[model samples]
Structures are given as structure tokens and as C-alpha cells.
Target: MHVVIVGAGEVGRAIAANLESSHDVVVIDQDGDIVDELTYSLDVLAIEGDGTEIATLQEAGVEEAGLVIACTDDDETNVVVCGAAKTKSDVFTIARVRRRTLLETWEGSQGAFGVDFMVCTDLLTAQTIFRISGLPSAQDVDMFAGGLVRMAEFEITSESPVAGLSVQEADRYDSLTFAGIFRDDEMVVAKGDSVMQAGDRVVVIGSPDSVSGFGDDIVTRTSNGLEEVVIVGASEIGFQAAREFEEHGYRPRLIEQDHDRAREVAEALPNTIVMESDATDTEFLAREHVDEADIVIAALDGDEKNLLVSLLAKRLGVDRTVAIIENLEYAELFETVGIDVAVNPREETAEEIVRFTRADYTEKVAMLEHDRAEVIEIEIGEDSALQGGTIAEATADLPEGVVIGAISRGGDLVTPRGTTVIEPGDHVVVFVDANVLDEVIEAI
Candidate 1:
């Protein structure tokens, strides 16, 4: 597949990095320095020119490309790029728009602009924060197919009522899949007979309604209950994080270096406590009760600041610490530094844009940290090896490290047990780590 990406900023770079492996990608940006930098790092064609210009699009082979993505920071530019690309050819086009009105009006149908997909990063990011915060006890919310499926991460604290029960016994309320469990530094693909233990980080996937039921029960009985969260930084990402945490029943404390900017954030978040303090200041963090906070979110624009704040929070005994890293170059350092999760906002935005531009047959493609691997959902063909075989037998030929979470058939979702058989036309959701995606695809 040939893809032409307009805008070579963080979002554009991310898209190129993800698609360069499987598709021929051309990136156009106005900055020559950025173009040269991207060309060296990513194996994609980089053109230094205005993406909205027809000449630039033509030079990038937009007419012959499989898709054209206009991901410039400006919404109008993105819309114009999409409109221009569609005017030239019948290629798939996706535009990144930040205006809420465009999305709200688009609820009825795709407008005459012929944009196949539109991504409102702020809106989606806001939605992510909102959904995560809604379930106060949920550590994270992973949505699939525009909220059709939801996966949540929750910690089983020492005081949890579900501490001693096996996964099969704990799932008495509804059908569930214990996708993975994180303990110490290891992540284990869970089995039905696996017993739940204290301090285990569990990833559960199921219908939205059932997932919420489990989260409520865990929140009510767990001592690791989150009451306060601290956000370090005053970027838009930080504001979104604070808003989401606040919605989840947590009182988030904001630490911003600038006093006036802190006041602005405080105005937007009436319930949150905003303070003017340097995030790198260890003394200030201690004085602000950062140690007692349930979670610490480092959204500082600078990578060094994010790293410092995360380390400080971790040292202060903040149980879970997440940092928003704009640069993919530093992703590897997070694991060694003990950060729980690093939120790649621009990368996420790029993934969403790519999904929007791709053909309808492509279900999902998720990129893991740095350049390690991708997790994708591929529909089962009529004659695929996955059909008409039990989970164990079906996966026997599949490569190792490919974990099948569930199979969606007709309208019913099944957590694949050893005896569970996958028939023709089933939509199997598999998690493939970075090393084995190709082998897993071959097996399927």
C-alpha cells in the first residue's frame, strides 16, 4: 500500500513510523530540517513542502497512493488537504480536525467533503480520559471499535475480596477474559485456573456493562482505592488527564511552574487543586503531599521534566506513575526507570488517523512502544486455519507469543477455552507481541 501523509510534526512522524513497515509511505512537511531528520530515522519518502498545495500532493503520488492522511495541526489545513486529495483521485482520505462542531454535525452522515475518516484528537483524548475517570477504580480503559468493546486494567490490592479466587470462580457475574496479569516486572498471559493474588495488576476485557460491574466491586472492597491524583505540568494533555481523573471521582492536584497558567487550569477544573510549583523540585513535591497521592501523571512538555517527575513520584511511593512522552526515542528508558506506563499522545493520535484512512476491511492496528511490535485484529477468512477447530488445536500451529483473547461470532463473544471451537467467519482478537506478528499472521 502506498500512503501519502501531510504534516510532518509529531503526529505525522508517528504515522510514518507505524505504516512504513507494511506500506510505502511518503511524508510532506514545510520544514526542510524536519524532512531530513524523518528521512534518516524512518524508511519513508520525505518531501519538504506545503501539504495543502496540489503540487506537493502530486509530487508525493497522492493520486496513486492507497490513502492520503491530512494530519496537520490546523483543522482547516487538514480538511483542505483531505478535500484536495479526494478531488484528485478515489483514494481513501482521512482528515484530522479538532473542532467539536465538525464531529457533532458529522454524527448524521459523512459530509459532502468525501473525507473517509476524521480524527478529533482532543475529542478522542477527552473521551478516553472521561471513560477512564468514570470508573473511579479502573487503572486504564482500552476501547475497541469505538466503544463496542472495552478492556480495563485494575490492581488486585492486598485487601481485595477477590484475592483468593481463581479467574473462573471470580467471573461468576458474566463472561470475562483475564487477558494478562502483571506482577513485579513480568506480564503473564492469564489462564482460567490462574489464581488471583494480592498486588497483581490484572487486565480484563469484556462487554462494557460487565466490565463496569467488576470495577465497581473492586473499588468498593480494595484499600488501594484512589482518592487523589497529582498531575505535573499544564499542557493540554495534562488538563485532559486532570479532567479524566476528576470525573473518575478522584481529586487531582495540578502542579504548574507558571502561576498565571496554573490559575487558568484551575478555572477550567473547578474541583481540582492547582498550585504553582516546579515539577523537578523535590522539596516542593514533598510539601504538596505528592507522596500520598494515589497516582502521579507527568505530562510536562519536556521529556527530562517528565522523566524527573516520574522518578520523583516513584521514589515517593506513588503506586502507579504514568508519563506522557512526546519523543519515541526515550520509550525504552521508561521501563528501566520504573515508570508504570508512558502515554504517547501523538502516537495514539497518529494510530487513530491511520485507522481512519485505511480501507474498511482493516479492523485494527496497534503499535507497541518505540519500534518493537504491533498488535492487530485481522478478520478470519472462510478457509483460514482458525476455523472449525478448538482453541488449543487451532493455536497449535500458531506461533508462540500470539495470545488469542476472544472470538466474536455473529453477535456472541466467547472467551476461548481449550474446548472452545472457532468456526468460519469468526472475528478473533489476538495480541501479538513485537517479535511474532509475522509468524502469527502466517498461522492465521
Candidate 2:
């Protein structure tokens, strides 16, 4: 596949970096310096020109390209680029529109002006913040299928009732399972015998109703204390996150570097504590008892600063540390830096766009990150070759590092074992590591 990317900004760079490995990538930006910088560093073909211009897009081979991604910071520019691409060529276009108003609803045209998709970064980041703070006790919430199914991460406190329960005992709850347990710096997918101790961070996956039920159980079993949240950097993205947290009754202490910027943020929300200071400084964080905060969202401007703040927060004993990483290239490195979650607004926004633009033949092709891996969802068609076979039999000749994580049959979800059969119409979620995506798909 050939991919033409507009804008050389952070989001454009992220999309290029993500597709460069698997697709023939061409990146266009108005700035010559940015074009030159990316041309030398990335594998993408860099073009210095306006993407809205038909000639510039033609020079980048938009006519031959399969996917044209407009990721400029300006929503109008993105729309223009998408319009030009869709008007001139048959390429699938994804326009990045940060403002929620620009996105409107999904019921609109699919390609009125070549925009097959639209991504709203602000909405994506804000929704992520809302989910986390909505469940104060839970460390974080990972939503799947438009919040139809939810995955919640919670830290087991000393007073929690599940402190001494084994994995099997916890799974006794009708619609819940101990998905994964993070303890002592290692992640363990739970088994029947696995135990939940005081310091363990447990992840549970279920429906929204089930999640609420689970939350109720946690509140009764554990002490219901106020969860303090401090967000470093009051960027629009930061403010968006703070807004969600604030709405959920978690008072967010927003730390901004510039005084005027802090004042601007203060005008928006009266509840948020907008403090003017450098969040990267450990001394400032320490003085505020940042470690005592239940959760800290370190969403600063720079990737390095966010990483440093997240690591510091973790070192200071913050329960969960989420870092807003601007550069998708440094996403995996966040885990190494001790950040619990790395939020990439552009890529996440792009995902919504990509999902909207996905072709009929493709089951599910997710852009996991700039590098590393992707989670591809596969559904066994009625006429498919491996329609009624077990996962072991279906993937017998499959390539390496391909794992079938879960299988959804009708409305029921199951973790496939050796004997677990995958019938026709079962939605199978497969995690395909970077090296063997093509081979794994071919085998299936």
C-alpha cells in the first residue's frame, strides 16, 4: 500500500513512522526544513509543498497511493488536503480535525470531498481522561467497541476485600475475569491459581454494567477515600483530560509553567487548581506531596519532559502514571521509563479515522504504534477455510509470535484454550507482532 501523509507536524510524523514499515510512504509539508529533516531521518518520501495543492499531491503520487492521511495541526488544512486528495484520486483519505465541532457525527458523508474519515484528537484524549477519573478507585479504564465493553485496571489496597483472593476466586463473579495482574514490575496474565495480594494491580474486562457492578463491589470491600489527581502541563490536551477528571469529582491540580497560561486555564474551570510552575522539577512535585496523589497525568509539551515527570511520579509512589507522549516513536520507551500508560493523541485519533476508512476485505488492521506490533481483529466468514476448527488447528501452520488472545462468539467472550473451537462468525482478536503480520494473515 502507498500512503501519502500531509503535514510534517507531530501527528503527520507519527502516521508516517507507523506506515513507513509496511507501506510506501510520502510525506508533504509546507516547511522546507521539516521536509528536509524527515527526508533524511524517516523512510518516507518527503515533499515540501502545500498538500491542498493538487500539483503537490500529484507529485507525492496521491493518484497511486492507497491511503492519504491529512494530519496537519490545523483542522481546515486537514480538510483541504482530504478534499483535494478525494477529488483528484480514489485514495482513502483521513482528515485530522482536532475540534469536536468539525467532526460532527458519523452519519455524514463518507467521501463528499475525499475525506473518508475524520479524527478528533481533543475528543479522544478527553474521553480517555473521563474513563479514568470516572472510576476513581480504578487506576485506568480501557474501553473497547465504543464503551460497550470495558477493561478496568485497579490497584489492590491493603483494606481491599480481594487482597487475599486467588485468581480463580475472583473470577467467580459472573461476568468478570482477572485479566492481568501487574506486581513487582512484571505483568502476569492470570491463571486459576494466581493470587491477588495487597500491592497487586489487577485488570478486569467486562461490559459497562458489569464494570459498574465490579466498581460497587470494590467500593464496599475497600475504603472509599477521595482520590487526588495532579496533571502536569495544562495544554489544551491537558485541560481536556483535566476536564474529564474534574467532571468525575476528582479535583485535578493542573501545574503549568507559564503564569499567563495558568490564568487562561483558570478561566475555564474554577474547580481545577491551576498552579504556575515547572512540573518537570521533582522539588515542586515533592513539595506538593505529589507522591501521595492517587493518580498523576504527566501530559507536558515535550516527550522527554513527560517521560521524566512520569518516572518521577512513579518513583515518588504515585499509584498510576499516565504520560501524554507527543512523539509516537518514543511510545514503547515510555514503558521502559516506568510510565504506566503512554497516551498518543494523534495516533489514537488516527485509529478512529483508520477504522472508519478500513476496506471491506480487511477484518481489522489496527496501527498499534510507530513500531512494535498491531492488534488485528479477524472474523471467520461462513465460507472461510478454517470455519469450525479449534485455534490450535486453525493456526497450526501460522507464522511465529501470532497469538489468539480472545474469541468473541455471538455475545459471549472466551479465552481460547487448546480445545476451544472457533466456529464461523466468531470474532477473533489476534495480536500480530511486527515481524510476521503478512505471514500470519496468509496462514490464516
Candidate 3:
């Protein structure tokens, strides 16, 4: 398959890198320097031209392309690029936009902008924040199999009860599976004897109840639980996040420095408390009792300000801190400095787009630890290697990095075991090392 991507920014570059291994990828950008860098950095063809132009689309072989993605910074540009690609060919088009209004417009009338799929960056980030906040100590969370199966990644702190326990010993949840463990720079496929050490990020997949139970056990929860929420900033992402929390039955507090923006959000969000004050003001925070909040989210306009807000919240005795980071390179730095979780909008958008490029059998994909590993839900076909055989028998022919996390059959959750038989039409959620993802997809 040939994939054509526009705007060689973080989102485009990420999608290119993920697909270049299996498909013929071509990236087009207006910036000569970024195009030149991508040409050498990734194993994909790079072109320097305006992706919204007809001549540029022809130059990138849009007619023969199976997928075309537009991910420029401007929403209008991305929509125009997709519309232009549709004029040239019947290729599947995806547009990455930051505005929820555009996504809603597209959703109301599918294929309105000639885009077969649209990814809203701000809305996706807000949804991600809401999902992470719902869990006790999760670093990342994703739902698969139509919300019947959930995959979550959690950090094992030294004080965690399951920090030093083996995988078998820590496997207490009824329908949970310890999929993989990510130690510093190393991806360890979970096994019965695999020991989960402190500082390791463990990925689990199971029913929603079981995953929630596992999370509660991993971290000692406060008596009040995660109730009080404070969001700093009136940026689109922050405003959307506050709205998400409100819709989910929590009256969150939103702090905006600008008076006009604060008044606007206050009127728009009936359940959220909008405050017009600088989030950096320590005295204001003290007066408002921000120190008693369960979680503080920094979604300011700039990365530096978000970092500062997250650090201040931590110093103010917040239980958890989540910050929205624009620069991908600063994700690790923010987490290391003190932020509990750093959400990158571009990364999230890339993951959402890349899932559409997977095989027809793959229903969903969740990238973990910045693509170190992946949890994918695939439906079993009659000719699949997994069908008509026990998991132990089927896995013997597979690589060591694959772990069958859960099985969904006829809308029922099925816990995977060695002797479990995988029938046709069963949706199996599997955790696989990124290195072996292609092989596993091909085999299953």
C-alpha cells in the first residue's frame, strides 16, 4: 500500500515512521529543511511542495496512494489538502484538526470535507485526560472491543504493594492480564516469573471492572478519592478538558489568566468554576485552597508555563499532575521533573491516525510508551493461525513478544489462558513489542 502524508510536522513524521516499514510512504511539506531532514531520518520519500496544490498531489502519486493524511498546523490547510487529494483520487483521506467544531461538522455530515476520517487533536487530548483521570494511578488508558476491553499502563512506585511482586504473584484481578512491563529503555514481555520492579511501567488488559480493581490495588487511594479537579489555563485543550470533567459529573475549577476568556468559559461551562487570575500567583492559589485538589492539570498555551504550573501544583501538595506538552521531546523531561503524566497532542493524534492503516482484521490499536509496544485488537478469521487451536499451541509458533491479553466473544469477556481455545470471530486483544508488531499482525 502507498501512503501519502502532508505537512512533515510531528504528527506527519510520526505516522510516516510507523508506516514506512510496511508501506510505501511519501511525505510532502512546504518547508525545505523539514523535508530534507525527513528524507534522511526516515525510510520514506520526502517531497518539498505545497500539499494543497494539485501539481504537488500528482507529484506525490496521490492517484496510486491508498491513504492520504493531512496534518498541517492550520485546520483550513489540512481540510484543503484532504479536499484536494479527493479531487485527484478515491483514496482514503484523513485530516487532523484542533477544533472540535470542525470535527462535529464533519461528523454531522460524513465526507463533508472529502475527508474519510477526521482526528480532532484538542478533543482527543481532552478525552485522554479524562480517561487518565478516571483511573487511580494510570499513566495511559485506552478502550478496545467496543469498550468491553480496556488497556492501561501504570507506573510501579517503590511504595506500591505490587512493586516487587512477580507477575504471577501480582495477578490477583479476576479478568486482568499483565501484558508487558517497560523498564528503563527495555521492553519486557510479561511472564509468570517476570518480576515487576519499582519504576517499571506495567501494561494490563482486561474488563473495565478488573482494570479498575487492579488500579485501586496498585495505588493507595485517599478517603475522598479523585474528586477535586483543578485545571489551569483557558486554552482550547484546557477548556475542553474542563468541559469533559463537568459532563462526567464533576464540577471542576478552571483558572484562566485573561478576564475575557475566563468569562467566556464561565458562561459556557455551567458546572465548572472559572477564575480570572494568573495560575502562577502562589498567593492566589493558597487563598483558593488549590493545595487540597486531588489532581492538577496544566494546559497553558506555552510549554514553559504548563511546566511551571505543574511544578507549582506538585509543590502545593496535589496528588497528581498532568500537563499538556506541545513538544514531543519535552514529554520525558516533564515527567522526570515532577509531572505525573505528560500528554502530547501530536502523539495522540498520530496514534489515532495510524490505527486506520492497520490490517482489515485489526479493530483498534493503542501505542504504549511512545511506540515501544502496542496493544492491538484483532478479530480472528477462519483461516487465522489462532483459530481452532489452544492459545498455548498457537503461541508456540509465534514470537516471544506477543501476549494475548483478553478475548471478546459474543459480547462476553473471556480471560485468556494457555488452554483457552480461540474460535473464529473472536476479538482478541494482544500486547506485542513494537519490533514484532508486523510479524504478529501477519500471522494472526
Q: Write the per-residue lDDT of candidate 1 for residues 1-444, one digit (tens) a residue.
A: 899999988888878876787789999999999999988999999999988888889999988998888888888888788888877889888887766567666555765466777777756665554455445446466655445456777778667778878887887755566676666656566777878888676777666777777877765532345577788887877887787777666677889998889989899998789998888788988887788876787888778889988998989887667777767668658845777666665666876776554435447755433324344566788778877878789888886666676667776777667788888777776666556665576667
Candidate 2, clashing residue pairs? 86-114
Once superposed on the true structure, which residue ranges of model 2 sit more than 4 Å away at CA?
Answer: 8-10, 13-25, 29-48, 63-66, 86-92, 99-114, 128-142, 145-226, 246-251, 256-291, 303-317, 327-339, 347-370, 442-444
lDDT of 3 by residue, 1-444 (tens): 999999899999889989989999999999999988998899999999999999999999999999999999999999999999999899999999999999999999979999999999999999999999988879999999999999999999998999889999988888999999999999999999999998999999999999988888888777457889999998999999999999989999999999899999999999999999999999999999999999999999999999999999999888899999999999989988979999999999999998887856589999998898999999999889999989999999998899999999999999999999999999999999999888988999
TM-score of 3: 0.98
Model 2: lowest-lDDT 10 consecutive positions = 217-226
How do the candidates rank by lDDT, highest first? 3, 1, 2
Q: lDDT of each prediction vs. the true structure? A: 0.73, 0.72, 0.93
Candidate topping TM-score: 3
Q: Once superposed on the true structure, which residue ranges of model 3 sit more than 4 Å away at CA? A: none
| C-alpha RMSD (angstroms) for model 1 | 5.7
lDDT of 2 at 300: 81
Query: Which prediction has the highest lDDT against the true structure?
Result: 3
Cα error, residue 397 of model 2, in Å, equals 2.3
Q: Count the backbone clashes (under 3 Å) in each candidate.
A: 2, 1, 0
Model 2, span 1-444: residue lDDT tens: 888888878777766765577679899999999989998899989999989999999999988988888888888888888888877787877888877656774326545455777777987887766666556456556655333455666767677777888877766565554556667555555667888887676766666676666765654422244477788998778888887777767678999998888999899977899889987678888898988887788878888888888888888888677888777768768865556667778767766555554444445555433324555566777765455777668767665555565567776666566577878777765656556766665555
